[model samples]
Target: MTLHQQTTRRQFLQGTAAATAGLLVPFASRSFAFQSPNERPVFATIGLRNQGWGITNKSFKFADFAAFADVDANVLGENLEKAAQRQGKKPDGYKDYRKILDRDDIDAVMIATPDHWHTKIAVEAMLAGKDVYCEKPLTLTIDEGKLIEETVDKTGRVFQVGTMQRTESGQRFLQAVALIKNGRIGKVKKVTCGINGMQASPVIPEVKTPEGLDYDFWLGPAPKVAYRALPEMREGYGGGVPLYSNCHYSFRNWHEYSGGKLTDWGAHHVDIACWAIGASDTGPSRVTPLDYTLPVEYKEGYPVVDDQYNAATQFNIQVDMPNDIEMIITSEGDNGILFEGTEGRFFVNRGKITGKPVEDLESNPLPGGAIEEVYGGPVSENHTANFIDAMNSRKQPISDVWSHNRMLEICHLSNIAMRLGRAVNWDPAKREIVGDSQANTFLSREYRKGFEIDM
Candidate 1:
């Protein structure tokens, strides 16, 4: 089907790029030459509940949203209806994203699925000649990281990771990196990263999966298991006790689907950590998990879950870098980063950026090319716009797979160290754990039969 021909009830529901107030307009009118009448770069999105909406909403300016895919019919069903109303067309909806990937009319895909399905779907989509925008924490494992990094280069297709911090403005997170790169921060000595560690999955007993939800597809690549209301805090489940927390947000807490808070928040926080330290291509050389005392027993709805929190609840991990740079990652304290340079130290997070030596955020002028360079040239309206631009240009997006793989590898390493309770050595060149069989197990997992990630 052609881009225009693909329009259906479901496509209209997924949204359209037609000019409208309070929303983005078509990039074609802005001088983007990639989308001709026959090549509009029709796009589809997998996982349409939360961030998926943001991606879809932003992409309306650049691509035609011809399809929407989701496992839970109830949740995405609302999104489909909204997309149709906004776009004034119908879109194809599917439970299996692979169906969407296989469409010849689709030139690209925006993936916002749970973490576990990221690498698999992205790899398949790229192989199918579709550009992809997979969510952050790009890979669930170091091996998947390597696979994605390799696959993108091999496929020679546009692929953007959802590391939107690079697109955010007036934030010291990226500014600090530019400052350090410009030698404003002097010689960097160490980086102390503070991220909340992963917590345990809920202790609730299994319950029936919700209707209109394909439980098995939702558990794609992860082992099949019964559902208990996965905790859904305002944002996501932190993998803890159940209450109003019993919804669909907490996938980050488990090793199966996500990197827990370490990766969940780490994808954002550590990404800045790497950016500020000027180590986006390479990661720290070593990860040593520092142990701390925890509750011997914790209450979960009146019964003890017995250390249900598989990931480290409290610990400090030290990562050694080349040139004598050291990264100290602490799971507690504040949620941000501390960059210690030869001359001074600076602390930055979502709320604030402060240090003994760095200039005030408002006072310091950013380098002329800082914003454009970070976004690969003048910024697109936002992260999704960047992806659409890359989709039409057939160029790499701001948060391409290689950069995100390197950043996420650090998160996976932290989890591996916390779980193994030891420091693991890494060969950055090979992208593998050095001589540690036990730790290597964390690299990639054995898929349960049909769900396996293929070479």
Candidate 2:
């Protein structure tokens, strides 16, 4: 099928960039250091819901689960039970992740909190001398990305963003990057990142906070608002969740908690595009929101209706990359990355990487070590394994924070422009949005008292 035609074939699973179960380490390929018998890296998992549970589950084979942290006491208890069943032991539990950070055994943490909490938890975890495996998007704002980068530099902790596509042992994404890097695609020109559109949430009325849930802590960093009943919390694009912890999975739909599809899937595809084009340490020169649709009435980047979701409903954004190449991120078609170079173009997603460059592998394969090289060095069994292995060896993980932040910068910039409905220039070196004061305002958000990430 043509690239455009494939967009409609699969509805695409959101956030999960790759399949987890089929991920197995090549018997000869798990790069682990020789540590003493008791030296397996111990880990804590904060945000014990969906993604949190998944990351922690995947990493347990390589690491020791020492604790569980979450605002919901019920979820925390449930996660502790799962951990006990998985590991034959249950570690400590805490409502405040800060207590987890305080523990002597938490060598690292898998931060799967909502987007608003990703930055603060990551920053403090590094400061506390704990390595971190944080799920994707990395930041709620551009400034948060910088703070995490700085913390990584100063703390020397192994910080890995959960963009597992980079370390796929199958090399689906790696092969695609290798094709572009080997100059097989000719001169790179543009990338079309067809991410899914934003979700619309219904207007929900305020209600009493659910029991066994720490609502105040759950709203950490973001503005304080009433519990908008369970309905307002769940994205209107889909049917409601059984529990009111709608912020756990549905948080991606609202700007206050996340950047909708821009940071959601864009974090995965845009990141691969950056890696392919050799721009992971920098970002686009300009970001322009060519067109957009908002779910509710918008004014000054926020929706007038407080009860409904505010993130963009749909958008076509154009970004000018470093080498005069263009990037088109749209919510119109498929959820995948299409790389177009001078010689040819190709498409890749969770399913398959296809096109001429990929087909060329039949006769003229990638240079012997191209896949390994694209993966930085030797690939890990999985994204979490990379972080745990890196913790012992002190090397950057496959999806290291620096490059993830660079890719995250692109995601944040895309959201900024879409929110403003205009073009904004970005200075990657200085890491600032230029000229427009209002546009620059988006580089950071005001935090709730005592919730700021100390840079």
Best by lDDT: 2
Tens-place lDDT per residue, model 1, 260-376, is 666877788778777766677887788777664232242321113421433445667788876688887777888888888887777777666676445543465554565345434
Instruction: Give every collision pair in model 2.
Output: 200-236, 201-236
Question: Which 10 consecutive positions of candidate 1 have the poorest summed lDDT?
Answer: 22-31
- Model 2 TM-score, 2 decimals: 0.89
- By TM-score, the best candidate is 2
Tens digits of per-residue lDDT for model 2, 185-219:
89999999999886576665677776888888999
Candidate 1's error at 388, in angstroms? Answer: 2.2
The TM-scores, one per candidate, come to: 0.83, 0.89
Clashes of 1: 22
Candidate 2, residue 277: how far the Cα is off, in Å: 0.5
Question: Model 1: residues >4 Å from true position, as ranges?
Answer: 1-40, 169-171, 197-202, 230-247, 292-309, 356-367, 373-376
How much lDDT does each candidate structure score?
A: 0.69, 0.78
